[model samples]
Target: MLDKDATEFDGACHCGAVRFHVRLSEGLHSARRCTCSLCRMRGAVAVTARLGDLHMLAGQEMLTLYQFNTGTAKHYFCSRCGIYTHHQRRSDPSQYGVNTACLEGVSPFDFEDVPVTDGVNHPSDGNGQKGDGIIGVLRFQSVGC
Candidate 1:
């Protein structure tokens, strides 16, 4: 459901060790903060796109993947600089959630009406188990980028 006229945005890490381009619709330019344990600790703002819409223009070798808890979601970062760039969310593995802060020439959007999803109580492995015993809790805050 993306507009045909969506533009490509340039982005990089704080230390310039990583860089990439993301094509996104204007409607999706806003940042999203998820209440997940690792996301809260890293202060990540997710700007999502379908897997086909994202491309890593550079720094592929510098990226490292981190997974914990249920180990379904993979958080990618710059190994040399420790800058989180994107992640594969457990809720939807088909989409890549890029960190909005890493995108250049964009500002954080006001999330007054954005719904906060609860991942803390997610069913383990899509099974009927009460819990898998891996608890990951998170909360988010936004500021000017």
Candidate 2:
């Protein structure tokens, strides 16, 4: 988990075509994964950030946007390296789900446990409330160096 005080982080794409700084809404405590079609395929752990909290520092033009299904969520990636960086949440339009691997000094494996949400039957889709859609938890265990 990230230090509670560590709200901000610098991030970049795999090819360095995109760079950004983000201030997490609740640091790594908001880390989660989604079982949605796109998310399941992307297989990324994400932390929450307010829409305005993410600031592009460079290579804005190198970023590409992808939206599908309901088209409420807007996924951004690096055009050069095709690295998913962030996405405006479909459940919460006010927030962005930032890829943990894109952040400096942070990796998906850094989290011992992360909640997995059921995006398939999303609350916004009239399935149920947000927390009620929790699928399960993903745990990471490091054995040896």
- Best by the lDDT measure: 2
Per-residue lDDT of 49 in model 1: 70
Cα lDDT computed for each candidate against the true fold: 0.67, 0.92
- Per-residue C-alpha lDDT of model 1 across residues 1-145, encoded as one tens digit per residue: 2232446778887777788888764445344666567866886657777678778888888999999997989888999889898887787788788876677764344333333444555554554435432343333355646
Candidate 1 has a TM-score of: 0.72
Tell me the lDDT of model 2 at 102.
98
Expressed as tens digits, the lDDT of each residue in 1-145 for candidate 2 is 4564578999999998899999998988888999999999999999999989999999999989999999999999999999999999998999999999999999999888889999889888887656557789999989978
Per-model TM-score versus the true fold: 0.72, 0.95
Task: Pick out the ten consecutive residues of candidate 2 with the lowest summed lDDT.
Answer: 126-135
lDDT of 2 at 34: 93
